[model samples]
Target chain A: MSLDTAEVRAERAERSGSRAYLSLFKALGRGWIRDRSQIFFTILLPLMFMVLLASVFGSGDTAASRIVAVGDVAVLDGADPDAFTVVEAFDLDEALAMMRDGDADAAVVQDGATVRIYPSATNSTSGAIAEGKLSALVDDVNVEVLSAAAPGEPVLETEVEEADGGALRPIQYLAPGILAWGVAISGVFGAAGTIVDWKRDKLLRRLRLTPASVRTFLGAKVSVNLVVAVGQTAVFLAVAALGFGLQLSAWTWFAVPLVLLGTLAFLAIGVVIGGIAQTSPAAAGLSNLVTMPMAFVSGAFYPLALSPEWVQAISYLSPMRYLNEALQSVVVYGEPPSAVLPQIGFLAAFAAIVALVSWKTFKFDEL
Target chain B: MDAAIEVADLRKTYRGRRTGEIRAVDGVSFRVERGEFFGILGPNGAGKTTTLEIVEGLRKPDSGTVRLLGRSPWPHSPELTGRLGVQLQASAFFEFLTAREQIETFAELYGATKSRAAEMLDLVGLAEHANVRCEKLSGGQQQRLSIACALVGDPELVFLDEPTAALDPQARRNLWDLMRSINAEGRTVVLTTHYMEEAEALCDRVAIMDAGKIRAVGTPAGFVRDLDAPTKVTVAAGQLSGERVRELAAGETVNADETAVVFETRDPRGLLTALASDGALEGLSVRTANLEDVFLHVTGREWRG
Candidate 1:
């Protein structure tokens, strides 16, 4: 074809704004999928953490204490079945033998109105709990006998109830926090490392010569990261719910927008590091330096309230903390969407501020 | 119509911790007409790539102005970028994309169709390697893919910076053909290369640059013709006696060594006629001045590249 006609054809074929964005999104997504190491770090690593933690601290169920009741004590009949398992022993020697053999946590001997509890030294925690429950049962029996013989009723009674209506298991808290941590990692490391690689490879220079603007390029990248974040959330929630019996509430849907915001905040930080770092390795190192410590202070593994006061104070500064809290509120605590409005606001502000900083620091060329 | 590129008094300086301030491009000015194949020939560190980058809008010059297709390149005008294609000195591709995928991405960025991208791959003779991962391609193949990406948009102007550098002889020759085809389409081509032979072979007009300055600018033949250098004639050393050689010299410079007798002369025909009559033309060879000689004459230094 003639040069003039070729130019005219190219001009006619020129695609506008969204085409570049979609093409870049597809390219980046395909690249990320093909990189096994990246997939391992971003998705599999967090899922691994979830599995390990869930197994270690299984679904908030306290193990039932085993108690050998010598000669079938009357008090044993009133014991809560969920809290204790009572075993009938013919004599005191049999009950002591059961405790010695590790078959029972403690043995109860009833001699007249006085009852003695023999707690196992090997199983100290369960032994102590069994001893306490047996002594309380003996006191209740004594109160019942005295009340029948003397006054109309006992002076007071105590009732037990959870402060929060539903049991908050450790796995429930960990699931959302781990998911948020994964999102942070993929967002920050993915953006920073890829940008540095592109710069080193001179792809940034090539892109500048094209008609697509920087905004279009970065928008495509951020969109890919967001999609990956959503995928991460799905995997984490499904594993937590199906494998560990983590309860989900209607408010859990709010995690989608929160994840997007959190990814944006992390990606903004990544952009700043990518702009500053000279190489991909350096960018990775810097991202880890920022994200690992942030994960700790943000309470991905535990509650922020359990940290030291100074650490808690610093936690307020970490965007990860806000993301974790927002996700936990909606996913684990079953709080309404409005309950996490402040956290969402904080995350949005962090993303905006960091994005502005990255924009100011960003450079298309090393020089 | 406006010239393809117009650069005036362009200057850029880089400050290094140890080197302090280095002038990368100093008071450089040149113009490339539409549909012209222009070459910037220089040695390493001569600022040819820097000048090309500034004109391509990849960098900001500290001072002076560049009018690319009648528009300022600075501040990154999208309209100007759409009409220009650039192949950088270094070839960089997206991480794991195939050759075709890489060019297709560039086509999308430039708003060209995938068919055009494929056409460009065919144009560069990479159609067979379309499915090959870019990292797996040979150095020459990678360079060709970069060129394909540059032209996928069918730009009116194209900039190539050392496109054939460090390639094998066959690859270099093949690339020369590709470059010729690019220019044959009537696209204004601006090329920077350190190889004098490359500049001589492909460029319509050549600008010789040294130490961040344009030493001279003209057609390759024009520069050599204007050099006013004498041709060298050489033959076996012992073919004739010293006395006879002096007689045949006729006031021209003559130097004799153990292997050959050399003559520097303005009139090669006269010298050849004399050698033929003397019957000392055995193993004789004549050498004409070329772009390398022009570079040495203009720069006052040996060609280091």
Candidate 2:
């Protein structure tokens, strides 16, 4: 075909748009990889958080808690010894001191028929976990006392049940949430910081001078970050499987689309912050304010069901919560694709709305 | 040939944090002919950059219209922007990308080839620094890289805002020649700068802006000639005392200082003849008045701010 032909010109025009998209994506990826700080924060920091959280919450092989018992051994007669290592203290003061000094996870004090557990609130996560275990043990001891009193009078029969899909280890439960958290970090912080930097450097002004639309530029950014998110998921899952013997359900493949949608949602959040902020530092602060709270309330570090009812209600507003729930249902519960459709739909709508808002607020010029 | 750019009654105002309203570009208008080298010359904050930006479609005028290639630039930015090249007044590119990569990206944005980008790099004398990251380049090199990006599209019209503001003397001269060559190839070049010499050296016509308005518009020599200022003659480390000074030139202005003796005269031949007869022609230099002298004549020597 002649170079001046209409067909050739149209082809060239089409190719150039895609070429610009690809070129921008590749350049952004290369720049991100070359900057060690960006890599550490976007990719490595999330993994580090995962590792730290898993080590703390998923190390189920270790002793559950260390309990200082301040009474005779009769009160703990029916409690499981393997669950918690019990220490004997002659007085309640000594037991409370042990708990305060960090020598023990909790102090169990008994006065006649009144039994109380003291777990320091300073270390909230461990304290809550230990207090829960202690309360369950105390209930077990009460059941034993009642059983002894009424041998065959049919005390209420209780049975323990797990979730629909067989039991899952803490690591298995946390892997998907942590992966979603990584995607959120890359989406929210990475996209916002990049936009803010571009605005500050007049790069947006330069781009505005070109024929490329704002959609194309932002599309390239989101595409590159999605690639990073996929790689992040794969690496984290691989590490989990290799180190902790994680067993993913057959429906685990559904997490890919879920993660991508989650990435878009988080990236929209970043775009909004970047558009609203005038400076890079302000963008950073705003992104943290957004993602940090969502990280906690959205079931990234813990299960949403474990939080209070009001907090769980609020988690519905966090895109991360939908991502975590959908990913966990696939990777841990072995739920079918239909099970996550609502979550996927919500995430898609959330991403679209936020992206629209961001676009409306974004300024191509300094004004 | 039709005009490449036509901006009429262009105005833009901004709200300052403490200064209230700032009329960045107040009722500025100019026309750039096809393939001509045009310039907007002014001091800092004189709204030259704002005018260029409005013409380039990077900004919108409050009440005026801009036409590039006979189409409105504002409402149809993408359509016009595809055929226009723009280099901003500030450094703007991917910080981590090499100069070559940055240029290639810009070329692709305009549906051009990487070979074209490389050619632009060569044209700007930046081929040697193609692989160097933008942040690592010297200020002059970065400025040149921006120029290469602007030209990578082989656009019919290119807008350069302070393209040589950060360059060294040699680089600035080289860029001027490069711009001239580009214009010679049937491309209109519009530039803005505070340096009058840059405008005089490169522009076919220049518009002098001050306080957000165009004060005068003409050819470089025309601007000087329009002022009707006299030719300047200086005698370095020499003086013509009163007796000889009166005979030097009858109706000319004379100013003498410790370092030099100066004369502004419309009659150079008569003054030269008198000086030669008096044997007081040592260390003499004569030149026509330039744009700077014209500017001082029109705007006065007071600092703009």
> Residue A314 of candidate 1: its Cα lDDT?
90
The digit string of per-residue lDDT tens for model 2 on B75-181 reads: 63555778888888778988688998889888878878889999999988889989999999988788888888888877899888898886889888888888888
Runs of candidate 2 with Cα error greater than 4 angstroms are A1-12, A59-64, A67-81, A84-96, A106-164, A211-215, B15-21, B74-83, B236-242, B249-251, B257-260, B272-288, B300-305
Model 1 CA lDDT for position B113: 92
Q: Which candidate has the highest DockQ of all?
A: 2
Cα lDDT of model 1 by residue, A1-367, tens digit: 3455766656643557678888988888888788898889877899899888776656224767798888757677788898788889899888878777788999887777667788988767668877877787788887887888888664577887765546777787888888888999998998888788877678877887898887787788788888988888888898889988889888888889999999999999998998988887799899999999998898987778888998899999999998998888888778998999999899999999999998887775572
Tell me the lDDT of candidate 1. 0.87
TM-score of 1: 0.84
Interface RMSD of each: 1.1, 1.7
TM-score between predicted and true chain B, model 1:
0.97
Best by TM-score: 2
Can you tell me which runs of candidate 1 are displaced by over 4 Å?
A1-15, A59-163, B273-285
**Residue B92 alpha-carbon offset, candidate 1, angstroms:** 3.6
User: Taking the tens digit of each residue's C-alpha lDDT, what string does model 1 give over B185-253?
Assistant: 999999999998999999999999999999999999999899989999999988899999898787889
The TM-scores, chain A only, for the candidates as listed are 0.75, 0.82
The local distance difference test score of each candidate is: 0.87, 0.81
